[model samples]
Target: MRADAKKNYDRLLAVAREVFNEQGVEASLRDVARRADVGLGTLYRHFPTREALLEVLLRASFDELTAKAKELETADAVDEALVSWLRETIAVAHSHRGVIGSMTAAIEDPDSALHASCLSMRASGERLLNRAQAKGLARNDIDGADLFALVGALAWLNDQPAHTSRIDHLFGVIASSILTNGVPVSV
Candidate 1:
């Protein structure tokens, strides 16, 4: 891609991200084009469909999260590392609340790229969980699937308009339970 084309693509991605976060996957491509100061053809050239755009956005978020998890592995305290990663994950989910819903819908399509994205995220999260568990900080039985489910539930619950405080409280409860070496608590 040419420099100008790359610039246009970046602009479109930024605009699309904002629009999607505000209005969800159903947000208008035309509005995105307008926001990016580009034509519909240009937007389509960069993202063939709404699903394509969503896949790119979600993959980017997952990649960032995985990188953060890797960095957190070196923290002085294993429990602290795990708690910090969970908090970061919650923040990411809160930032991309609508994108999570769209990604889930896309993943449901048997051959969707979102399925591949999900697999990658699961593997990345598993590595982080395994590392923390190996340190004898996180609960032995707490697997990546458990963390994924916890994050998903928290993300869904946090998406509600009036649940910010509740989400934080829920996250705290989950962090304490999962980070505990003993049996997980019911929160």
Candidate 2:
């Protein structure tokens, strides 16, 4: 890409993140372009579609979460590792309002722009969950898909104004339910 085009792309992404943070992921693309001081055509040239733009923005975050899961693999306690990753995933989902909906949809839509990244992130969490289950720490009845759905549910709960104050307590409750031996080590 030309220097100017690259600059515009970077600016658009930065502004989109800000706008999405303030207005949720469903915020208008026109608003993003206006906030970035770029023409709508310019934004389209770079992103093509809303999902495309979101794919670029979310891919980095998903990669980071996946890497975090890998690092947590060697944590002293399998249960702690799973709970920590779940907390991180929920936090990321909550950071971008309405993103959990896209993640949930993407997981079911193989053709969605975010499908691959979401799948990979889910797989990473699944590995952690499996490890915990192997050690008889996490519940065996729940699978990775169930764990992923729980993350979306937790994230959605956090997005609710009335439930905001209850997130931490709710997280603890959910984590404890998933664990088998005892309460999950505080994550």
Candidate 3:
């Protein structure tokens, strides 16, 4: 964790993020090391496996989202806070092309390197949803698992060239469904 080694680690992480965005979780560690101008051993020294790198790539955003939700939970505009956080979640998932595919599975797998991060993200969203629901703003029946499914659907749309353009609309639709208009929603 010295200056030079830390520098290499950061460089490898940056390169890995870029590479993962372009080529996905299966992107080559060798290529990541090459792009970072570090040796393969250095990359391995920092990240043991592809899953380890993927976990690091997502952990920052998840932590940020969780922090944001904590702040937003106290906001006067509860629905807006939840919707904004939901959209931000979509954007985070969309940032890496194939991350959504892996994230859903990772969230379910207790042993995955990124499971705790995903759980933190989910808990954050649940807090927001509860805040909105408490004020009769959001549907009480829905939960974070519903949002996870929407993330997967939106991420799928994001991956396709044609449907990407409608992502904003999709986000709105989901938000509207979650945020109530005083009518009782069964599910």
Candidate 4:
């Protein structure tokens, strides 16, 4: 890419993050291009579709989360590592509405541009989870996919004022269920 094109791409991704956080996945592409001070055609040239744009915008965060999962693999306590990783992931998912939904959907959609990124992150998480389960620290019933769904659900609940308070309580319940010989947390 040319210098000007690279600058525009970076600016567009930055502006799109702000817009998506403020608005959502359905945020206007024209508004994004306008905010980025680039032509609509430029934006289209960069990101052909809304989902494609989102996938690019979110790829870095996905990579970061996956890296975190890898680091947690060597933590002193497997259970604590899993809990910490889950909390971190859920926090990211709670950054704004529609993020978790997009990730969840993209991970399952084989045709999505984001699918490979999603799979990479999921596989990293699954490695940690499987290791924990092998040590009898985590329950064998759940997998990385299940954890992604749980994170998405928690994030959706976090979006609403009324359900916001339930996040910790729900997380506790989920943690207990995932841990072997764990006690159910009081809601």
Task: Flag regions of model 2 displaced more than 4 Å.
Answer: 184-187
What lDDT does each candidate get? 0.75, 0.94, 0.84, 0.83
TM-score per candidate: 0.80, 0.97, 0.88, 0.91
Better of 2 and 3 by TM-score: 2
Candidate closest to the true structure, highest TM-score: 2
Candidate 3 structure lDDT: 0.84
Model 2 C-alpha lDDT per residue in residues 44-112, reported as the tens digit of each score? 999998889999999988999999999999988888889889999999999988999999999999989
Candidate 3 scores a C-alpha RMSD against the true structure in Å of 3.4
Q: Please provide, for model 3 over 1-187, each residue's C-alpha lDDT reduced to its tens digit, 9 standing for 90 to 100.
A: 7999999988898899889888877788899999999999999989997778889888889899899999998899898888788878888888877888778888899988888998899889989998899999998888888877877788778788898787777767767787887432221
Best-to-worst order by TM-score is 2, 4, 3, 1
Better model by TM-score, 3 or 4? 4
What's the distance in Å from true for residue 50, model 3?
Answer: 1.5
The stretch of ten residues in a row with the least summed lDDT in candidate 4 is 178-187
Q: Could you give candidate 4's per-residue lDDT for residues 1-187 as a string of tens digits?
A: 9999999999999999999889877789999999999999999999998888988877878899899988998987887777887787778777755777778888989998889988988787788788889899888888888877877788788877898888889889887888885756343
Per-model C-alpha RMSD: 3.3, 1.1, 3.4, 2.0
Q: How much is the lDDT of residue 114 in candidate 3?
A: 84
Which model is ahead, 1 or 4, in terms of TM-score?
Answer: 4
After superposition, candidate 1 runs with Cα above 4 Å error = 105-110, 182-187
Worst lDDT run of 10 residues, candidate 3, spans: 178-187
Off by over 4 Å in 3: 182-187
Mind giving the per-residue lDDT tens digits that candidate 1 earns over 96-180? 7565665555445767767777666666677777877887767788787778778777887788878866877787778777775
Residue 34 in candidate 2, Cα distance off native in Å: 1.1
